[model samples]
Target chain A: MTFQLIVFYSFAAWLIFSALMVITSKNSVKAALFLVLTFASAAAIWLLLEAEFLALSLIVVYVGAVMVLLLFVVMMLDIDYAALRQGFVNKLPIAIVTSLAFFGLLYYFITHGEFGPQNYANPAPKGADYSNIKELGRILYTDYFIAFETAAVILLVAIIAAIALTFRGRKHRKAQVISKQLEANKKNRLKIVSMEASIEETENSGEQEPSTAEEKS
Target chain B: MTSSVNFSIISAEIFLLVALCVIMIVDLFQRDKERKLTFLLTQLSLVSLFVMGAQDLGLERQVGYSEHWIKDQFSTVLKLAIYLGTFVALLYARPFIRERNLMRGEYYLLTLFSVLGMMIMVSANSLLVVYLGLELLSLSLYALVALQRDSNIASESAVKYFVMGGLASGFLLYGISLVYGMTGTIIISEIASYLSANQANLMIQFGLVFIVVGIAFKFGAAPFHMWLPDIYHGSPSSITAYISSVPKIAAFGMAFRILESSFGEADIHWTPMIMICAMLSIVLGNIVALVQTNLKRMLSYSAIAHIGYFLLGLSIGNDEAYSASMFYIIVYALMTIAGFGIIIFMSSENKDYQQISDLRGMGRFHPWYALMFTLIMVSMAGIPPFIGFWPKLEIFRLLIADGQVLAAVVAIAFSVIGLVYYLKVVKEMFFVDCEDSPKVSNSRSLKIALSINCMLLLVFGLMPDSIYQYCISAFASLN
Candidate 1:
């Protein structure tokens, strides 16, 4: 194979393997990290397709932002996936059948259907000076404005969901409770008490006191 | 470039977004435990939105923003209904949240966002908009389910919903990618036109399967409905009520928008699948629900069965049946909300009354509320002279008329089976006696809201054509 061909096939293989691991890995953190690998390899594939902007975004957005958020959720929720999977064997047959059927359908389409290379012809090689990001941005701002705004709203919703679900405000956070702070007075905020000392500490204090008295004399 | 961006048409959405932000800022400054101002502001905006949606109804169907946003009778009517439902839900939610010390402003904010998302879904003209709207709605719902953070059950339920919802979304996104790859377009109207003209290829068929799965999952139809009961049982009752009611309309709208837009001509493929889900959901939801003692869990299974009925109406592939399904969802929201509201009502600061046994001697102690509860449960059971009966009647009639005789018979049978549990609750409330006197909710506003909600069922059941005609006219362009 040519160099580019070798690179693509290798990345594609990596993409598939990692994607499989994403589901099969029992540890959620491992699955999440495998998801990052999946995204990275997918982005590499996108770069091979000469879509530079998409590759970078796939890295910056999905791998960086979305995966980080997902990791946080996995850490925060602490769901018992093991307990959730208590009846795995009983469900395995049906799940396997469903997945295999889907796979078979996809296989049929990939091998024998009209959704083929002829229907989606590859683009001509672009000049090195070309910028798809600029082109994509033009349409994104002008034509797909509504979809863009809706996406922005969805992001806003994600933020609200995160804050609303987990933020405990003053309870768990070190946030100052203004009312409690304001209500604090000298007696409540500070405590001063006279106490009898233990034997050693008392004797040490007495000696120190006598020395200080001698010094005063 | 700006020719198609009709700002006034989507001004309602813009208004809501701006109002939501304003409320957020205002709430940030508030120290009030009840969040009274936030609630008032949210209700006021929802009222304004209801009026706006009403004004927009019956207008000529308008497409704007490069045909990405649509304003038509189909959307406007549903939007109005959603607005009204959310208004009542929040009013009922107030005391419930207050009692539990969960009365943060974020509850109203998330709910408002969810409302905004539903409105977007109804009016969305493109697949991208539909996906985004679905995400906004679902994310808010998941958060709201988990809002009572101190409860272990609530948090676990939220986790379950989040996972299932994410899987459903993934299925939908995969389907969307396949549809786009096959059709070379993401505009829903263009996709519809194309699919109507050409035979679907193998990939399109595969994609439609995923789409249907996603739709069924969102509707909580059987086999894909693993998450509904646990969530309903585990979440705060007020949140359970909210999720059960307003979002059903949005789900109906999303399914219709996607299915009708993507596969109306290829109905032969998807129809059988939906019919199967309907029967499965009906049988499973009813049978499993029969054993539930907790009213919330029982109502959740009932919700699943109701989804089956709604799906049955929708499967007929005609304007009349579509409207019938629309009416079913709207009425289901009403009946279900009132059903859950009674449970919310039963709770005071100390106790949450959710068991069927909790209703023991309620009729003996509080006759007026017991009558209201009876009406709600009976309506949910599809009894006559209640709003719930009309939708079921319409679905069965339309199913038979559509020549699906066996499906119709199966649905009617399961609906009868579903009635037993509701009647069981009614029996517990009226006949079964408890040694201790019942402690009904003392919220005046909640009782008033619940009364109005339950009464509308009987009033509209007497003359359902008032709502039925609106549903019919909303789909006037379908033929």
Candidate 2:
């Protein structure tokens, strides 16, 4: 029990530290990395709570995929850190005050209210063969189907919204009509010139050679 | 209160989902730039939804899908109202969107999707469902606001809306989390039962505070309303017309469901915060509206004021007040749609008439439209003989009946104070003189739609009880 307690306290502390770093890091890439650490520690905490499914999904989805993409984007972008921090000092007081108030309230409740191990006992441990995914799926599909479907629709809206807002069709694009291209029989596209074999035309052949090469490439 | 699985309770929702998918695909194959086919299909679906909801109004109130979705008269009435409001809004917005070159297939699709979102919200029986529905609605509106990509103002407003909406969602999720922790449940009816059995805890109180703040933010009650006027003014007038009217009703539904259905037994802790938001919205909305020159912006403030009245009714914490608030929101939605429809009518393809002064000589130039506009403005001002007056009177009467006479009188005085701005628009349309009139939209369909909308104010005003009873009956059956 003491060993488990030590492990939990360490992971919990690490989670809080990394979460703070995620917000306070100066470099974007560093912040993104800190976020990954934050998620990892959170997953550890969830595992300690016996929510193995949530812990695994959190690692697989957020840290493995989302954080990697975030890191790539953060590393690639040319962000102006100074400009981003221009109003940080001015806003710090209120931000600090608001967060402090929230923390104080949360802390008070954790200590004085209907929280802690005295009022709320730990959840019972499951059997070794328990399937977290199966249990989750049973309740999620049967009980929360409406919420699940609504969430699916929200994702659909996001897709529609992204495409609708960004997809401006090219109005003036010049392109070959495939039908017209397919209909070409060399009857109209190609014409034989009988009087073009002059000295000047032959001298201009060098420039045309590169143009034809460009088209071939 | 978990029940056997019954998908049939959500027959209307299922139909809407299938119809929207069909609409989305049908929109892709449509060749017309105006998307006439998609528009017709969308309206037809809404009408059918209205019918379905009306039929459901007589059915037994049941919490289906394991208490995750509800089918009750309250949700039914709200859904029917949403359907009717969207139908009118889309019709009125057609010319406006067409003229602005925003007749994309996605426009209709997103609006319908948002309607689905609202339908879900009005009937949501769980916090999870509420959050999902709210996100769907918010996401669609953000995209719709930013539909005009070329307009910098629209993009700005969309970002503002997205950020504020994200914050509001964050607050709500936090509150829901805390509530779940305290009560060990997320279902609405179950939460009420749990809350009634449990003692008041600081965590739950904090959670309820966060939830109330989130609701007030969604409702655009002041202190959380800094984002409203800008978003309304920045969105294309048609988008503005649609967003301003319909979502308020759905937000009311979601709030009522959560606060009353889930936290009704614990209203004592939340009502004070609601009353504060109500008072702040009233004072701030009215005084600020009086100074606004932009008519769209002014109407946005007026919307804020109307929100105050409804929130006041809500804070009263009684069935009668709830019904009155419901009636007020329905009336408010109808009037605002017509009011913005006038803005749509006055502006031509090349120009937008948004300034209050732009209505100069409208009465002289277009007598018929001007008359309808007058009725709309008069009704909005709560003048007797118009529909808006009855709802406000009902709210005020209920407030007095509940022994909050001072607040009722104060609310009435401010609404009367709100009269100055509504009448200002009226005076601009009539009293001001001009040599020539600006070219207005000549869409006969819009004209017909606006005429119908304005006539409703008079029709319902002369006999407010016709609609009031439906609202009364809706709350009569609420648990």
Candidate 3:
């Protein structure tokens, strides 16, 4: 029991530290990375509480997908890190005071509330399956089935509606029709007119050019 | 098995689903040019739903699988009000959708689905049912807000709505899990009974707080209401009309279910929390609305203030208080519909008159519509001779009767603060002058509908006894 308390407190302290780092870090990328750590620690706490499914999904979905996307977007943006740092000094006093007051209230609430160590301990097992994933699926499918289906349908309609709104005809541009290209074969391309040059016309052109050249000379 | 599944309990939801399917099939086969037919069918479905709800007046029944659905007068009254609000909003939405060339069928389908959600929510007897209903309403709203696909603001609003909604749902689900863990039950009545027997559980108290947070967020209470103004501003005027009215009724229903049914035994824990939320929402919602330039955003803030009033009733936690909240939601929904309907009428396809300045000289060009809007605004301000007055008066009376004198005082103060913003819209409509005068052209059907909606507010305001009596009886039956 002592060991478990030690582990839980360590994880909680790590979470709070990383969360604070996420806000106060000078570098944006570092801040995002710290946020990922904070999420990981929180998930660990969830795991400690026997919510394995939620903890794993949180790590995989939020940490893996969402944070990665956020990192990429943040990296792509043209942000002035120095300018961001300049505002910190001006804002630090108020930020510190507010956060301290917030943490103080939160601490008071947690410590003074009825949820003390005695209440936090797990109760005796009731010998029933309370697996998070299993119960979630059962409730979702049986009781909340209508709503689940409605959400799916709403998303489907949103997808189709978005596609329809964006797709438009390009009517004004002159483009090669695929059907016309398909109809044209090697025979149409190879058909060329062969012209024979007339000798008398060629001689007259040559003589007129020479006379003009002599006059100029 | 089939005999156990009582059809009457879920008749309203089943009827709405059937109507939605018919609307969808009609829209699918019909051509785009036949938009008017789609609108007609949508209006017909909503009206029929309203009629079905009205048919069960004062009738007490329980239905659905394992009696997890209820069809008492309370549910019927709420469902009736929601259907009426949806019907009016759809009528107002038609011209806007037609002018924008948006997909009419899908819009109507989503609206129908949202109304169905509200019905399920109000009638829900189980936590699972309540969650399902809330999600249905929320998901439909997300898509509805983004219906104007080409608009960046609409897409952003949809995203904001999605994130906030997702967070609120998480809070609600966590709370549900906690409560389930403590009581081993999800049915509201069962949980209430369990908590009544085992009121010493700390887990139950924590769970109740989390659940109330989720409910407070839905009601647009302060500190959790950052999404409300952005969504109201970003969505189209017609969609805003829908968002500001019916969903609030659903929120009230959910609050009633959670506080009165599930956590009534733990009133010592919840009442004080609700009191805090009520005070903050009232103060913040009113004060923030005072400086708003956009009418929709201002109204959104005003909605938060009104929610504070509703919460006052819930905090009182009495039979009269419950009925007063019910009456308040009905009147609030009507007044909001009338207000947004006027905005819809004035808004043209080429221009959106969302800015308060755009409403300048509107009283001169459209005197009757302007008068109707003024009546709604006044009612919204809680003035007498309007429906809004009765709800406030009833709530205050119930609060005072419950010995919550201080809460009653705070509510009255917030009502005055709310009046300042509502009067701002009125001032813009009547007094402001513009070089280019506003000209509103409405279809004959819409004109008649708007007039009727406004006149009912006045009529109900004068003779609120019947509705008030009905709500009181409904609460009595529940207890």
* Higher-scoring candidate on DockQ, 1 or 2: 1
User: Per-residue lDDT of B408-459 in model 2, one digit per residue for the tens?
Assistant: 8888889989999989888988898887885688999998889989998999
Residue-level lDDT of model 1, residues B404-470, one tens digit each, is: 8998888888888888998998899888868887777788999899889889989999999989888
Top-DockQ candidate index: 1
Kindly indicate the candidate among 1 and 3 with the higher lDDT: 1
lDDT of 3 by residue, B1-479 (tens): 34445666776677777777777778768855547677888888778777767778878656556546667777888887788788888877777776775646778888888887888788888887788888878878887887788788988998998899989989998999888866777888888888778863777888888898898888778778899899988988889889999899888888888778888888888988888888888899899989989878888888888888878888888788888888888778888878878878787766778777778887877778788888888998999988899889988998888888988898898788788888888888788876676857467777888899999988998899967887887788775
The residue-by-residue lDDT of candidate 1 on A127-209, one tens digit each, is: 88888898899889877998899889888988877888767666566767686689789998789998998666564786697
Which of the two, 2 or 3, has more lDDT? 2
Clash pairs, candidate 3, are: none
Second chain TM-score, each model: 0.99, 0.98, 0.96
* Predicted structure 2, TM vs. truth: 0.87
Rank the candidate models, highest DockQ first.
1, 2, 3
Q: What is the CA-based DockQ of model 3?
A: 0.10
Backbone steric clashes in candidate 3, count: 0
Candidate scoring better on DockQ of 2 and 3:
2
**Mind giving the per-residue lDDT tens digits that candidate 3 earns over A1-217?**
6986888999999999999898788889999999999999999998777778899999999999999999999899979877767878788899989989999987875676553455466666434466778877876665555456545645655554564445443668787667568979988788787889766656479669889999999
